[model samples]
Target: MKSICGDLLLQRLGPEGLGAFGKPLNRGLYECIRGAILDGSLPRATRLPPQRDLAAELGLSRNTVMYAYEQLLAEGYLRARTGSGTFVADTAPESYLNATAAAITDAGPRAMPGLSPRGQQLLANASASPTQWGAFMPGVPDLRRFPHRRYAQISARLWRQPPPEWLSYGHGGGLPALREAVAAHLRVARSVRCDAEQVLITEGIHQAIDLVVRLLGSTGDQAWVEEPSYWGIRGVLQVSDIGMVPMPVDDEGLTLPEADAGRLSGRTEPAPRFIFVTPSHQYPLGAVMSLKRRRALLEFARQHGSWIVEDDYDSEFRFSGQPIPSLQGMEADAPVIYIGTFSKTLYPGLRMGYLVLPRELAGAFQTAHAELYRAGHLMTQATVAEFMQAGDYAAHIRRMRPLYARRRAVLAALIERYLGPGALNAQGSNAGLHLVLRLPDDADDVAITAAARAKGIMVRPLSRYYLGTPAQRGLLLGYACVPEEDIGPAFDVLLGCLGECGHAAHVARIG
Candidate 1:
């Protein structure tokens, strides 16, 4: 019996070598003997040779063999009677574990469980583009031109002597220094009325709005959003089980919802509890909110006790005229939650943004944000603060402003020359990084978008932005990320696609 066990041990530790298991000699020896015992090569009540004898036979040091024996004994794989040598344990996990593995192997493949209702709804109305980078992918910026060298230097410097708080999860919105830097910048640049205490750091606008919705929004409540606004927040609201009322937008931003006396225009719906607006440069349309409309919206929110959520997403690179002031700062004690993100100004991967809450809500939001999101990215916040302090952030934006303006000009001119003068959206006030190319209302924009995608150009159908009946057919052409020279070639491909789709500018003009 001892010979049988020894033979099996040698077989396991033999041709493959003792180091075959990628473990130390002792651990390897222990594993080999334990496996032999579990497989019943050494039966219960079978006495074995002394440790020294096994060591001699195996060509291992006495202590290595001793260590292997000790481990087996400790793990109940082997036992020693006071007067007898070590033997295999009376029972082992082999009977149960081996039976389980065999049963599972015989059971064959399995189908995954079904998703929850919430999970199903999330997949239903997807907004993100599969092809994120290319000639005309909308909302993506030029990552190639980011100031990586300066950011790296700034990051390295801060990491060398970082304050302890910068290395850990933060409380009180974010690092104080970062909040102060953001506050100072927003006040001068966007004319937002906020102090350092009111600014709360976030991962991005997504997380910022998630916090807002979770904190303020109730399930089954209604919110008003621009008909063709960014799909992100609407998705957030939907997942929260909040209903969306798509308000129409024109040349002066979101048109006030029509009056049916006290109810929503043309419907019996109640007034919205929340209003989401992109005032500076309306997302797809690029219509700046006129002073009259902005004032009217504020008064409505004030009168109805509704919260106004202002998403100042990409106003930093405004290329024409003086900058539009933020809707939040225009009124004292305004019921506004101001959201801004660095996704547009800096690279999207940075995932840094801030919110300027109404003064009363600041402290509660800081606590709630820390509790809900477990706020992190202290190192990123610190680095951005250092960059701002050194004026690199401002300088970077200044450099990028003109670069984007030049790209926009080039793309706009190309559209004019190739697609004709009426190709552009007249309401798209020459400011943002993209241009909305108008199309015939009768044309099938979804079909055109698919055709353009097949031709290797990435433009979103303007109709896809609308939650209600699409008012127009068009394409969103993003030039910021596209190289200046490549814009022409890409537009040529797109123009050909327009012809193939039979929705060219001439058709729209004739109709």
Candidate 2:
């Protein structure tokens, strides 16, 4: 032990760091030894030098070294065996030093691994907002208004005496009561044709879409997606290696001729295995699929053996006429999977969503869901079931609809008043939590959105949702999460940004 210390000590403790003799010698020696132990220069379990020898080497009084050694011993940094000299303690500090050294060694230069081609594609198409809740950040509900105390009371009651089965892994298809509640609610509210047995609960729309893409389509299979659709769906499909055919959408909803032409023109690509649509209220653009388009879509899918995924997200907040009936319920056995979530209705943290599947496909989906991801969260499901069964869910929606409508009205009124009708055209504002503000053809939506973000206003660029060249430039301004009082101020900030961009463009044209 002494030999080890002798070999390393001189180089480890430089002359400059060690104080001159008789000038705070004890404190200087203590600091140097402590630093050595902390830096791993004096390894764990190594015996420190004898006080007499250390004092002799440094030409210091023996008392100075003795005081330093005593301080270290008292601090538990060094331990003395009855017959053996002092050694470094095997304590948390020593272990931390060793761990830090190992980390540094492992960080040595090496080739960093790369993501798979599919993963790279997903990354390239990622569109998640950096800030989830704020002014003009789309798809986020105002969680502040949620009935937290009521939900907490229910949660506490359920946890006080949880069912033994619920304490373990839950059924692949969610809690039976929740399924029944969701089925009953949908049947009456959205006209979705489904029974409790046909509803499969998922984490959210993302997981539901993932399950469909994996189960129904093979890798590289074509899928018809509404151009300027939800970016998240695009990422999910891309990661699954499904080829996406971007179909244009007008006020009526997804156009059928473009998809039909692609199939009939002998494009050499495989027929689309699925068509994903937001029929009730299209995301970002907010167009409700017309009844005519709905019938045509169903017929086309039936003929081509393609499935349709109807993402009816946020359809409950419609301010106009009665809610549109789901496309799945429009035709018998329409090969449609209807998805709805509580993220918009309640809160996103609930992470509870359901799929209304065709009777024939229910069993397969349930089995696949179990095998792929063992579903849990039975307690939360049970609580939500109670919320729905007790009529709380319906009452809550009725209460929130008007509040969201008022906020939407304020946003629309401000947009028209500030930007004028010709400066920006608002599309699909009759329903949904967000509206698309179309800018001039030459405007740079991305640059304008970035400028808004710098001013603490959150807005998504419309062009980011498109796969091919964007036909129009715009911003997706969400009004649901923004408070009524803050809406005008937030829009004021956004207006300044738009003015700056417009000024820049005008100057560039003159140049």
Candidate 3:
């Protein structure tokens, strides 16, 4: 060999490589030389042939070889010594190639590096369903009925005449216009005591919960979460590494624990720092927190210096009279943080909700929220503001209430018809999108849930919602997404999935 194989580049470049298809030879030559160096066809430090000699060998002009070499040199793909020829630079691309190959070989039998321990733990306890929308899918709205025309019209209009901050990442406490609108709506509809300044907009209820818990919660702080509560909220707490004490839920909502945590556990937990409750309508089980209990919760929080996170979920669709007023508005300067989501009222994908914080702490939380999530979506927020201010939001809620009411009635009847009257758990049936269908204690709710999912219905196992060993067994069946006409057919499908042990007894009595 003449010091180094100058023909290696030519061998890798191939017969049709540089001049193929009438492509520009200079650029092609550059790429071919670079590729050879990158792929190890031309080993590092291997000197290339003289430009004139290489051009003559390849039947190209001297300028072409010079151009490719000059480009490669300028781009660090080649190095030149004072009197020596062009050579491939000592790049570590080969190490990467070797590592990739080694990884493939090692991956076959090895446990690869996985997520963080906390991340792995959070995922291991996850309960979110793969399929979100189907028969009896809880918390999903009727997607067909979303007011797309108005939202699009407003969105297009905003984009057409865009303002300076139309899409800006400003708004520490969310867009002022949207905050004002939310404040007005909550004051009127929910009786939430807040000015626009107190409203902290968020992506949704989960974000609101997470924000509160992370900011208000501290090391060794414990939160009183309702037993048989929303799993999503619990997941957030677990990820934050905050301890939770599952308080029971009865018809009155999250029941106050009779004994101190230390007394029960034989170890003193720091006096609880937060209390989470769905006071408007209890989740999975529809019980409104009584005014007495609400007052007591307020007093307890006052005593313990705890912040009560009141999730006013699905309070708008009450079949009877007006929805319950917020726990935040219960007493002046009450230690309650009222949170609500547009997911239930509008649509889940809308991904907007708000927190009505205490006026004393609102600004600090707003700054923290801005720093944390880097809140934006001014356009969407503004559109919703316009919609609510113009009474369109209330109008949508007005229309949805009766529609959901009819579907709920239809589903309830079918449950009573097919699964028997006793199977329809009356506790959570009166309001909200979903109701519980009780099963016997020994019944396999998880198996029933799986079977129903296989058959294209989606009811949740009640036992999964519990923070402790489940007190009872049942299934949560949502009627909001299911149309009136679809309820009977869906329940009939679900009924077929139920085993004879718990279901047939009820069915037999009916028969």
Best prediction by lDDT = 1
| Candidate models: Cα lDDT each | 0.85, 0.82, 0.83
For candidate 2, the lDDT comes to 0.82
| Lowest-sum lDDT 10-residue window in model 1 | 96-105
Q: Name the better of 1 and 3 by lDDT.
A: 1
lDDT of 1 at 105: 24
Residue 119 C-alpha lDDT in model 2 = 81
How would you encode candidate 2's per-residue C-alpha lDDT over 1-511 as one tens digit per residue? 3456655655555665455334586887776677677677786798777878877666678998899889988987788998799998887354645664223234667998999877877777787877777899888888898888888888899999998998777665899999999999999999998899999999998999999899988987999999878888888888888899998988888987635543745356666798999888877687788888998898788777889999999888889898888898997778898998999999998898998898888899998888888889999999999989988889989988999899988988876666555434434747778877777768898999889999898999989999899987788888889999999999888888988887433322211
TM-scores for every candidate against the unseen true structure: 0.79, 0.79, 0.78
Off by over 4 Å in 3: 1-112, 259-268, 500-502, 506-511
Instruction: Determine which window of 10 residues in candidate 2 has minimal summed lDDT.
Output: 502-511
Those runs of model 2 whose alpha carbons end farther than 4 Å from true positions after fitting are 1-107, 258-268, 423-426, 503-511
Tens-digit per-residue lDDT, 92-182, candidate 1: 6555456521231247679999988887887887878888888898888898988899999989987898788767778999999999999
Error of 1 at 75 (Å): 30
Error in Å for residue 100 of model 2? 9.8
Pairs that collide, model 2: none
TM-score between model 3 and native: 0.78
